[model samples]
Target: MTTNAELAARFEEFADLLEADDVEYKPRAYRRAAENILAHPSPIADQLEAGNEEAVENIDGVGDAISSKIVEYVETGEIEELEELREDLPVDMAALTRVEGVGPKTVGSLYRELEIQDLDDLEAAAEAGEIQAVKGFGPKTEQNILENVEFARTIGQRQLLGEARPLADDVLEYLESVDAITETEVAGSIRRWRETIGDVDALAAADSGADAIEAFLEWESIDDEIESGPEKASVRVGDVRVDLRVVVPEEFGSALQYFTGSKDHNVRLRNYAIERDMKLNEYGAFDVSDVDDPDAGQRVGERVAGETEAEMYEALGLPWIPPELREDRGEIDAAAAGELPDLITQGDIRGDLHTHTEWSDGNNTIEEMVEAAAERGYDYYAIADHAEGPGVVGGMGLSDTEILEQVEAIREVDAAADIEVLAGIEANIDADGEIGLGDEVIDALDVIVASPHSALDQDSAAAADRLVRAIENPAVDVIGHPSGRLLNEREGLAIDASALGAAAAEHDTALEVNSNLRRLDLWGSAVQAALEEGAIIAINTDAHQPATLEYVRWGVHTARRGWAEPADVINAWDLEELRNFLH
Candidate 1:
């Protein structure tokens, strides 16, 4: 069966192969079609199979050529042209492109010059100084490819939360129609909101576990059924593995708590429970104080609580802990002392402070982005387009004169906008931590977000001091994506989070938990350490388009992982409070 994910992946591959073969406009069309297909709510295969050709044609970017390719793939299970392109290049496009700077053209060049087919081949060529000899290639590109090879090799071992969570939600929705199912939820790392997930795990509560498992296998999104048993099943959805476990309605809570663990967290909690003469496991929480051996069996004593997750914790006189805080990082102690923070929620964000407009590589115009934010009921919004400097790519960043002109443009729009619109600039923090903004430009802005775009390979101490210098710059209001890391793409920078956080707190500057899925900088542990010094955090989407303003959801959960409360996040504040902080 063709799942949306599988079809999108094929087109993505088609685009890469076409690009490698140097096909021009067609590649972008295929890629855009693939993205739309992945995001399209209905299945193209089902539409094609049902003879609804118009539905497929109506999809954005799916013109005559792309639509026919979809039909051919659906009807015959293959596209003849894609196979030919694959044969011509015959390289692992996905794996090869995972290296930071290696694109289709680079892949085409390397394959033509050095016949590099995979990471192994690329690494061999780079190590032997072969890549630098190729035209338009040099030592820097070769070394970067070599350095990124291992990370690229291990890229698909885990799925991004942004990708997997939606699939899990689909699973829950599918299982809801099962008559026997009493409850359902995502489990494991996905539930904990880890940045990457190994498998999409889900749980269902039902009187008949076998019936629930049967229903799960029939899910329309499933690409293939891997295994199914009486109480559990595993299946492949797109490229990721999804596992479903069905338990008795009575034991649902206990199962959820046991499965939604970080191993260390469960171990610590189990030990804590043992001290209270209680035994905990998937079966249920048990009062084994009078039992001869709590270790004798999985369920050795009278079950005290198992009907609900809260009861499972209540059995031990503790409040139910949020899954994001269950990483064995003092959460257990905090819970016991009633000190667990009221973690920030997605609803708390009032506006986005780090958005872009077409003025700086954004897809939408300034008016469009601000209107979209207004539609989401944001109390305020800010336009912090990139400022021209060393790392600004292709001269995309704005010049000082342009920024000032844009500032005037924003003010004119702000007068008519439903929400308060702040004029801002995302100035590049150079290697020496200096921003390129002129004093007049800074004076005109409502907020200034400083970010590092180059020299990301600085040593830890240098990285820390560089960021500290930015934090101490009175003109700067927020530091964005402090580490500059792109998950699975590159290990961007290694900064001393504690030192940066302290400097930020001292200077009253905010550190950002950039909401872009690839750059959730100031991740949980770092945020927790920084907040210990009373540094404020701002969860900005760094959105480049109107649609991506919703990326703030990823940012909110990321802040929660750091045990952030409503008070810790700046944009979560109302208009006045946010303005006060920005000033």
Candidate 2:
């Protein structure tokens, strides 16, 4: 089946190919269609299969031309125009675009000028000092290409949580429908809410393993069966691989604990069990010291605990740890001492501080965004549209005059709404640590989310200093996506987070944990460091559409991984308390 993700990738590549050829307008249209298709709730293949061509065409930003291509790909597994474009520009667009400063145009230029085809060819040209000889290219550009090509080469193949979670849910639902399956869960990194997942691991408790495996193999979404047996099966669903394992009811707890792991965490647990003259494995926890052949069989010992995950932990004399805290980053010690912080939950959040509207590259209007927040039961919502400056292109950022004009527009929306609307701007933080907007414009807003949009390759000291200066600004309320990193793509700024956190605490500024799966900046470790320094966290979705507001859960879980409490997050406060903080 042609999945929505696969279709989106094809359209994105098509856009790149067009851009490389210097074709204007159509490339942007294709990219917009691709973004909406990727974010669409239902699979495009399903709609096409159901003969809903009109529905596919009606998708936001998709038109007759793009929808026809989608239908063609769905029916024939190929798009004629895309194939023609590929033939014309037979270069690896994805690989070339991975470099920091390289774009589709750059790839086209390099290929035309030096016949560079892939990363290796590009590297050879850079090493041979030939890229600088191309028109519009210089020595610095060649050096940058050389430095980033290696990082791009090592980029791991992993699926984002936003994409993986839905497929996991589908598999879990299908397995649960089997009469023989008693309990089922998604384990591995998916259970831990890792930003990127290598594969999906689903576990089941069943009386007859054969029955469970049969049900799994018959799933509607399974594209290819990799392997199968009575107890286990592996299948490819779309582009993701899923492994299914079934165990008896007695061993479900142990299996879950073992499989839902960071390798380091499991190793520590196993060593801890050894010191107490016990053994721990996927089968169960057992008293090994009393058995002559503890390893003789899978369950060959005096079993201590295996019925529940809490029992497994109790056998080790520790509290039941949350899966998010299973990263072996002092979580064991914290659990043993009963000092683990009370983590924030979905119900704790009362408002959103970062969002966009049609005024600045967002699809929805300001009124639509405000109403969406009200529907979510939020007490307040801030409209932090992009402010014009560096890295702001395609007329996607607001001028100072335009931003001031939005104040009244926001007020008009707030007048008939249940929630308070806070007019704000996402100001760009220049390399010199100055905000793009003037102080008067900054002072006029209800909230200011200062962010670094350019100069993302600074060294550690420079990055830390740049962020600290932003934190020290009295007009700034939150430092949005502090590191500017994109998971599995660009390695944004490398900063000393501890130093930056202390400065944020000193200046009463909050650091944002950007909730977009692609950019979960101020990630787990950074959030932890900031919390330790008494800095506040604001988990914002950075939402551009109504559906994206649900992403706050991702940020909340990421925060829980860092030991954040409801009190530590500003958005979790009540309206009065939030107002006090803002004031």
Candidate 3:
């Protein structure tokens, strides 16, 4: 199968080539194709094998040449043209282009003239006084490259959503404090609530665009300034790239709607506008048919202005699309059919079904966790600390005997506090599908969450069987982090989710959308499949610490991606219904 990453990398390489050649339209076309391909829901190889070239061409901005490139790359391991281009250029193209202000043309020039192949080689040449001797290379250019190389290596990968959210909030607050900035919105994947974020993008409507850009560049929190132009400024803040674009108030909503995109969603929306003899872009929408000239028409190119996101959607004859559901899944269809789901809100969740306390590995005690839940207006919560045996070690989890004692202890805290705290245990599902805690202890707890903590290397078929059996256990109320994947660091167990979801539904068990940003497993597809099989989803934060309870937002957003409505989630029920299901 052709991984999306591979296709994206190729598109970027193509973009690099087009830029080096100084071809305007080709570069934008490739970049747009890359964006659409990355946002596609299914694997490109599956579409190709099914003989659906339309799937490739259906993407917005993919032209014939770009589609052919994708087909050739999938059939072979490499793109022939990219390979030829690489051979023509002596530089380590990827590495050279990473330097700030150095694009592919600069790389090509440096490689042909100075013979720089890698970051280290470039640095050595710059130090040896060879790069400055070249015609187009100046002392400033060489100096910048030498300084940025080490920073690039130490900058680390992009920030995960868990790390970026607070930073984005802080940025928005800072921007709002500035008098010149009138409106602000965080755009890009962070806005889309993607699991991982490469950058934090903010678009602002300002009274004075130039002043706003200058103010953003001078912000104290910015760790490093990457680029600052008249309308935009890019900075690096604690391993996350933050880009801010300043626009006029008149163009604010239109720009926000365009920039806050799952590119695929915007493409579809744009195509919808085109079908209706209208046009949409970052500036605004325009009525094409109203213009006299189809080719040389100015009104067709003119902005169909909007001052709010609702106006943008309204012009398109639909309701506003939430940023979280901007990914091109079925959102368009839902919007067209007027069947958009009433997404589960934070307030809709009446209880926190899975949490930890000092009884296991959690930082807070039972009373503290319950009080925090109460502070958040939750009517009920479950203290699901770890249970002993199998994956449990270092006395981090309670023994079977200790679990019964803790249940009584939980009741005491629940009675004292104003909130109801159900006794629960996060029991381990061993290799053989058996939970670590005995049935007697499990039966005593108000909620039993069975999770896989070991043997993650099992074959896919075996992994699927293990999960199915665990969910089938009458005492198991929830399956925790179905795939157990850790973003960027690890790929967890793979299971046939459809089979597992069916089993869970048959057994009256609920599947959890583990809200730990690091592990958003039961991903969107799994959630959708689970819902299709009539399985209820529990959006649990699986909070080990007080601050982590906020992660439920990401989980709920993830559920929206899976097409889960308020009714599809078990935790969205009242306290009594949730308790009944646990029993």
Best by TM-score: 2
For candidate 1, give the lDDT of residue 185.
91
lDDT per residue as tens, model 1, 1-583: 5766678889999988888888887887787677667656666777878889999888866889888888888878789998998889989888898897888889999999889898899999999999999999999988988888998988747777766776787788888888989999998998998888899999899999888888778777687899889998999976789899999989999999999998889999999999999999998999999999789999898999988888988999999999999999999899999999999998888999999988986757889999989999999999999999887755799999999999999999999999999999999999888988899999999999999988887888788878888998999999999998877666667977788888999999999999877678878888998998889999999887665676787889989999999999999899888878775
- Model 3 clash pairs are 285-304
1 or 3, which is superior by lDDT? 1
Q: Whole-model lDDT for model 3 versus the true structure? A: 0.79
- At residue 288, candidate 1 shows an lDDT of 95
* Model 2 worst lDDT run, 10 consecutive residues: 574-583
- lDDT per residue for candidate 2 within 1-583, as digits (tens), equals 5677778889999999999999999998898788778777788898889988887988878888898999999889899999999999999898888888899999999989998989999999999999999999999999999999988787647888877887788789888898889999999999998888889999999989998899888787888999999999999988889999999999999999999997889999988888888888998999888888766887777898986788899998998899988999998889889998899999999999999888997888999888989999999999999998787657589889999888779878878889999988999888878787776787688889999988998898888888888888888899999888877668899977788789989999999999987788888888899889889989999988876788887899899888899999999998788777773
The alpha-carbon deviation from the true structure for residue 71 of candidate 1, after best TM-score superposition, in angstroms, is: 6.5
C-alpha root-mean-square deviation, candidate 1: 2.7
TM-score of 1: 0.92
Q: List runs of model 3 lying over 4 Å from the truth.
A: 1-156, 291-302, 393-395
User: Distance from true position, residue 197, model 3, in Å?
Assistant: 0.7
Query: In every candidate, how many clashes are there?
Result: 0, 0, 1
Scanning candidate 1 in windows of ten residues, the lowest lDDT window is 35-44
- So what's the TM-score on candidate 3? 0.71
- lDDT of each prediction vs. the true structure? 0.87, 0.88, 0.79
